[model samples]
Target: MMRRERLRTSESPDGRKVATWRLVRSGARILRVQDRADASPAYRWPGREPLPLGAPGLVLFDELAPPDLATVREAFPGCLDLWNAVREDFWHALLDTSDLPASGTKG
Candidate 1:
């Protein structure tokens, strides 16, 4: 299945960059995005599983760093088009997904 994403970057307290690619579906429902870092932890990370975080969109981020305009353009060739489409499609996707039951229990 195909999912969507957008880039995010921020500065940490120590002046280092905190970069991530946010996961969003058509309706702008943000799930989760892993950090843009390389790691060799004891367990496999989110994107390393049988199905990666963003599915078909996984290839858009092969670089080991956060995405900039240049990187996005180079990766997708027409990044603006995809961005605009995401803008247009986000709400509808959310409404469609809202039909499903919420995941966690309220107790």
Candidate 2:
């Protein structure tokens, strides 16, 4: 099992909401940290709000399930080295933590 902790939540320099999370697998000293953006400014259509980038450890869009390793690899084909270091369990846990609703949000 892994533990997920929210390290910080704040607005990015461009004003998009952003957050950081810490992931730790049980009985392991390795600490994995990931950052998430609520939306991506680089890929938004004109006259529309930006959507989540959905990249590994990068953009975590609300209303979307955590992406799988294959998806991350496909999105960032150049980041072989980085993806190699990610564990499947950790990735799932990381995004699962992010998928949680805001403190006061209701279904």
Candidate 2 root-mean-square deviation in Å: 12.0
Q: Highest TM-score: which candidate?
A: 2
lDDT of 1: 0.35
What's the count of clashing pairs in each model shown? 4, 0
Give the Å shift of residue 25 in candidate 2. 13
Report the C-alpha lDDT of model 2 over 37-69, residue by residue, as the tens digit.
323333221223434554434444222233344
Q: Model 2 — which ten-residue stretch has the worst lDDT? A: 25-34
Instruction: Indicate the residue-level lDDT of 46 in model 1.
Output: 28
- TM-scores of all models? 0.26, 0.31
For this target, which candidate reaches the highest lDDT against the unseen true structure? 2
